[model samples]
Target chain A: EPEVTQTPSHQVTQMGQEVILRCVPISNHLYFYWYRQILGQKVEFLVSFYNNEISEKSEIFDDQFSVERPDGSNFTLKIRSTKLEDSAMYFCASRGDTEFFHFGNGTRLTVT
Target chain B: AQSVTQLDSHVSVSEGTPVLLRCNYSSSYSPSLFWYVQHPNKGLQLLLKYTSAATLVKGINGFEAEFKKSETSFHLTKPSAHMSDAAEYFCVVSGPTGFQKLVFGTGTRLLVSP
Candidate 1:
């Protein structure tokens, strides 16, 4: 089965540095999403993308966060300036018209 | 607005015993419900989903869920628990007509005791 794939399984960055988390969604999937889970916390939605544009975003997805589909296969999330609170497991997911979603093994971001 | 609520933050069950994880949802329209499991340091795995199809939906790993509209609940159940079943489970809900954003519940952590 085709699955979503993310790069940099784990990352460690300085508090003020910028980082880009990359994902290659399932081939032929139209919708893409990003979600994060703080240690010991529920997974929280960050943003959703379709047609190379953001469909919706949560409060956590502030100005510091931006998503781009720079290429046909790559969906990237960029944090302008990383904060300590930005440290979490970030998961990229994709789904077709159906409700079932395929998630990539998350990228663990650690900012110190 | 749609949301999911997991009644229990943690559940402990013995190996070979039945497993139940209670979940309730609030949605203004017909919703798609799902159950996902996550092992340590891993990503979320879709166990099952209910999209106005059969009320009883079966998923991987011998897990299943019943969608009860009257009760506004989609509870996951398993016939027998295993040590591998010990993980964090999340209840998710999404409206059919909206932006297709999934709302996740505070997860329920299942611990299998031998």
Candidate 2:
């Protein structure tokens, strides 16, 4: 079966540096989403995208965060400036509709 | 708005024993419910989903869930637990209305003991 794939399985960056996490969603999937999980915490939704625009976002998705589908297959999440709290497992998920969702292995972001 | 609550933060079961994870949901409209499992350092894997279909939905890994509208619950159950069943499970809900944004529960960690 086709699966969502993410690049840079793990990343380490300086506290004030910018970071980009990339994902290639399943082919033919229309909706894409980004979520994060702090160590030992529940996964929190960050944002959702459809038609190359953001559909909804959570409070955590502040000005520092932005998502782009620069190409047909790649969906990326960019953090303008990384904070210590931004260190977490960021996951990319895709779904054609409500019935099923496919998630990528996730990119572990570590900011020091 | 739609939300899901997983009753137990952790559950321990012996191998071959039955498994049950409880979940309750609050939704203003008919809801779409799903159960997902995540192993260490892995991504979320969809186990099953309920979308106004039959109340009893069967999913992968010998798992099943019953959607009880009267109780506003969608509980996951398995006839027997295996060692590989040890993982974190999340309960999620989505509103039937357009936008279909998913809201996830805190999660339930299952530990299958030998």
Candidate 3:
């Protein structure tokens, strides 16, 4: 089965550096989403994208964050300036016509 | 709006014993519910989902969940626990626009012992 894929399973960066997390959603899915789970906390939604634009975003997805399709197969999330609190397991998910979302293994971001 | 609550934060079971993880949900419209499992460092794997089909839904890995609208609950259960079942379980409800967004419960940590 085709699965959503995320790169750089682990990322380490300085507090003020910029970072871009990458994901390749299932080939035929129409919707893409980003979620993150801080250690010992519940998973929180960051943003949702469709038709090449952001449809909705949570408060956590401030101006520092942005998402782009870039191409037909890749979806990227960029954080302009990282903070120590940005450390978390970021997950990418996609869904087709069905009412189910498939998730990727996740990218563990660590900001020092 | 949609939300889910996992009644138990942690549940322990011995191999060969039955297992249960409770969940309750609140949704403005008819909801689509799902159960996901996560191993220590792995991604969330779909266990099963209740999409207004049969009230009882069976999923992969011999796991199952029942949706009771009157109770607003969707609880996960397994007849026999296995060591491999030791993981974190989350109960999720689809957002109003369907699967566009998922609201997840805090999660229940299942510990299976021999």
Number of backbone collisions per candidate: 0, 0, 0
Global lDDT of model 2:
0.94
Tens digits of per-residue lDDT, candidate 3, B82-104, equal 99999999999985664369989
lDDT (tens digit, per residue) of candidate 2 on B1-114: 889999999999999999999999999988889999999999999999998989999999999999999999999999999999999999999776555677899999999999
lDDT of 1 by residue, B1-114 (tens): 989999999999999999999999999899999999999888899898998889999999999999999999999999999999999999999877545978899999999999
Model 3 per-residue lDDT at A51: 87
lDDT-superior candidate, 2 or 3: 3
Residue-level lDDT for B41 in candidate 3: 90
Which residue pairs in candidate 2 have backbone atoms (N, alpha carbon, C) closer than 3 angstroms, thus clashing?
none
Residue B10 displacement in candidate 1 (angstroms):
0.6
Q: Each candidate's root-mean-square deviation in Å?
A: 0.9, 1.0, 0.9
The TM-score, computed over Cα atoms with residue i paired to residue i, of candidate 3 is: 0.98
Give the fraction of reference interface contacts each candidate recovers.
Answer: 0.84, 0.71, 0.77
* Residue pairs with backbone atoms closer than 3 Å in model 1 (clashes): none
Cα lDDT tens digits for candidate 2, A1-112: 9999998999999999999999999989899999999999998999999998999999999999999999898999999999999999999999885557789999999999
Q: Where is model 1 more than 4 Å wrong at Cα?
A: none
Deviation in Å, model 1, residue A5 alpha carbon: 0.6
Please report the candidate that would top DockQ against the real structure: 1
Every model's DockQ: 0.84, 0.80, 0.78
Docking class of 3: medium
Clashing pairs in 3: none
Alpha-carbon TM-score of each model against the true structure: 0.98, 0.97, 0.98
